[model samples]
Target chain A: MVKVTCPICGGKLDIPEDSLPGELFEHEDCGAHLELVINEGRFELKLAEEIAEDWGQ
Target chain B: MRIGLAYDLIRWEEKALAYTIKDLGHTLELIHVPESVFYLTEPTIRGLDVTFERCVSFYRALASSLTLEAQGVFVVNTFDVIRNCGDKMLTTAVLAKKGVPVPRTMIAFDKVRALEAAKTIGYPVVVKPIYGSWGRMIAKADDESSLLDILDFRENMPSPHFQIHYIQEFIRKPGRDIRAYYLWGEVPVAIYRVSRNWKTNTALGARAEPANLDESTKELVIKAGEAMGSGVLGVDLMEDEDGRIVVSEVNAVVEFKNTVRVTGYDLPRKIVSSTVEALKA
Candidate 1:
């Protein structure tokens, strides 16, 4: 498991080891949607982009 | 076969699709849209049997698929399908030409003519922008004043696309609509997006329930797909007061998250497997 900190709630999140860079996850503690971003083998979490006007099925 | 998933933001559908591709023992390439740059003329993207366009934004999906397709990479739903489905006017026109049942629709370049068309179509008309999704900017005008009020807002919009009005007769549906997943020539699964609200889009907080497809509905779904060039489409249909089904919209980059939750079907796997299998044929 990959451990990361939730930027919104300062809570730790257990992410799957196989999670990709662009994968999105929601923080259970604060309900903040996050994006898992990896660079130089280091993992960081950032708030996911808000739904765009043109977003839908 | 090598596969690429070009995405703006990876949602549940994207992750499930990627896992399905990997689990099936195919090479998976994740093309993150925001960080990646596409060379239009030079063409750096290559070597993928098929690339799934999963971008949330219709414009982003269209541009990304166009770039990859230019490099001879086969894209699901194709550029033409995306372009056609992205615009409400094009979707309605294409479906109507294919003999598919569609709501009575009219187009006007200006707000005054739009109000005029709406008046002709009668009250309780739906005014939609040429380009939008998730029921954004879709409004119902119960009468001329309401329609004029709606048109007044649309006329002042800076974007020319929003300036053009596409009006349709409001079909009084049964508090829900059918959302069918059309893959290639067949509809593997479908669900009813149920809500008290007139707009039954799941993105607008509708509840999804598994819908058994009848023969007539299935045929309509397939026809809609064929009309849109047949590649992964979300064919939405509504039952009018007269009990006739009409094609409400066809979506190119369809989301299956809710359908999976309600139906317990591995839609991502089905979509991936069928797409890759077709390429091998």
Candidate 2:
């Protein structure tokens, strides 16, 4: 179990490695959508708000 | 090297590939694909060793066969990615689910739900066919009556009808959108598609001009392509009202005549190189 801290609200949550690629899981506490990016030997956590804001900008 | 170019012969873009292949000293076999191949069903799949009954299935079959048969098969924007990108509803859902930036979009199964969703999203929404390309069947509903008229027209259509989820919000610059061309996950060239009309597609007679790519735009294009799992993609983007670059659509196999004219890049050579690498892998 890997614990992920939400970038938006700074809340903590656990995510399994078997979670679907590109799946958007919301933070239970803040309702902030979180995304998982997987690459070679690297994992990145992204906030949904950032995606929305980046595209809007 | 021998390369198999698979596309419908009726499409003008296919000729572009042939020209490029000939220029690169490669033997190109132009395989004409039928529309029925894309919409194959059980009844259509009789007496074959393999049966492709769905659009996705057909795409996979085509890709797998080419990948196996050719020494360096360049499937110009692969069929799997094309199948996914061609469906607006599916593409929107997948992008949104994957945390990609798109407009406020919704899909409805029927006309009533579509109308309600349109109203909820507000006026000036763009209604598109679920499987449309080149900006066909796209209607801008500015009021309730226009929305209703579109729905009524759609409902009265012949077989295989579905209500598309329209998008409403932050109308961007008209007749201006960016097309970032990627080959093997790297963007070699980009173009700004400009038009006097609402649609910014070469097929719609839009003019193409060279565009400079900033780091942010490049990053966004790469991210959008990665999200869609397409190695080669044309990431269509537009700046919204807030100047944020929102992804409009992602094309797996993009026509590059206009892009090449603008950027002066040898697109087919790049694609062939990528195809060789992919096949080796």
Q: Pick the candidate with the highest TM-score.
A: 1
Error of 2 at B208 (Å): 1.1
Deviating ranges (above 4 Å) for candidate 2: A1-57, B10-12, B22-27, B34-76, B163-170
Across B3-81, the per-residue lDDT of candidate 1 in tens digits comes to 9999978778888999899999999998988778988898687678899998888889899989999888999979999
What RMSD does model 1 have?
1.7
TM-score of each model, in listed order = 0.94, 0.68
Error of 1 at B10 (Å): 1.2
Task: Put down candidate 2 lDDT per residue, B81-160, tens digits, no spaces.
Answer: 66567666667767778878887887776767877887788787787766555676677888878878887777776636
Best by DockQ: 1
lDDT of 1 at B271: 94
Which ten-residue region of model 2 chain B has the weakest summed lDDT?
B47-56
| lDDT against the true structure, each candidate | 0.90, 0.62
- Candidate 1 chain B minimal-lDDT segment of 10 residues: B39-48
